[model samples]
Target: MPQGPNGYDLTVMHPFRGARYKDSVATNGRYWAGPLTHFAINTATYLFTYHFFANYSTEYPDGFLSEQTLKSFEGVSGERGSFKWKHGAERIPENWYRRQPGNDYGILNFALDAVGALQALPYMAVIGGNTGEPNTFTGVNIADLTGGVFNAATLLEGNNAMCFAFQAVHSAAPDILKGLLGNVVLAVSKLTDALDPILAQLGCPQMAKYDKSLLAKFPGAGAGL
Candidate 1:
């Protein structure tokens, strides 16, 4: 899901234009820009969330995460943890981020004594721009970045598939799930390929390859790694 662009630059020749014309231009710009920006941000957030979680949550011998880290994070082994639906739904008391770490979301916590010290100047300065006027910062939205139930579910499916793929690769055995996920990745990578120009322009990271054999092993074994 590649968003072509978040916004545009409109240079209107306003010397002879009426006030209504200028207002209409501004209103129309805001109207279309709002949804375009929203859609772009939403799509970027989902992709970043999925790729970040999928890559980071992976367990080692193949991925960066260690077994103990997975245990501590999920309170279960990587294999078992992958199947569990984990997200920030309020109803679930054991939602991610509730464990040993402090529940307070840092300086934003209202209960803190230094709440007054947290001045609005800095926020306004950054958000309002150097000219002391309102502006838009188009970037990752952290609040919505983790995503919701659907994201968790799909991530689990992909992660579980990755786990199975790794297992099958190690055992030199074929797994249907591994093949399915691998094919999905390959297929999706095609879209990334098509959007490479835009993605590169934005400096967005793309998942290059898992294991070289991920593509080869599922359909057949005994190929070189």
Candidate 2:
């Protein structure tokens, strides 16, 4: 049986069959490996499709802010206006418009719109109905798997935070000041490991044990993400 990221046996992913009699010849040889192989292949194909779409889509938009509004905020802050959230939906804040500046509001709006459009393209292509598109799969629309409708409020809040962080980093003093700030951030990251035991005690999700076998491969198989 194949082991998962946490060293647990993946019984469902790879089931074992009992020993066969020597006189009995298996008629369906493909049945043994076919399903698992196809599952892996299909999974790999979809994952690659998702990665390619995500990387290429974000590159074209430049900043989270669109081209039309980006020029307005170019010199206002030395920071790059086009920051993107890795987990876009989760990072968005609840209230954005009321607290952020006017220019920031525009930039946030542009970023949200661009992200929404770019994200939707892959979903549409993979599961969109018969709209005469080349890559669309008419069988079933799985766009909802991506997420629900875009929440402008949450997106704005997240973008505002992202832009603010970028601006703060850009505006920070050089030399000793920057070095101190870097050290603080590094310390915080290192200390985060200490919280794992506390979180586990509180019944929160605990970190998975590192698997050396997955050193150069994807580390999320059977992780139940």
- Model 2, range 34-146, lDDT digits (tens) per residue? 11122223223333222222211233321122221222322222334554433223322222112223223233343343333324332211211222322221222111221
Worst ten-residue run, lDDT, model 1?
7-16
State residue 211's C-alpha deviation in candidate 1, in Å. 23
Pairs in steric clash, model 1: none
> What's the distance in Å from true for residue 88, model 1?
49
Instruction: State candidate 2's TM-score.
Output: 0.18
Query: Scored by Cα lDDT, where does model 1 land?
Result: 0.26
Per-residue lDDT of model 1, residues 29-139, tens digit only: 221111112222222332322222221212221113223333444434336436443454213112222212333222122112111111211121110011111222222
Mark the 10 consecutive residues where model 2 has the least summed lDDT: 16-25
Off by over 4 Å in 1: 1-37, 41-182, 204-225
Q: Output the TM-score of candidate 1.
A: 0.17
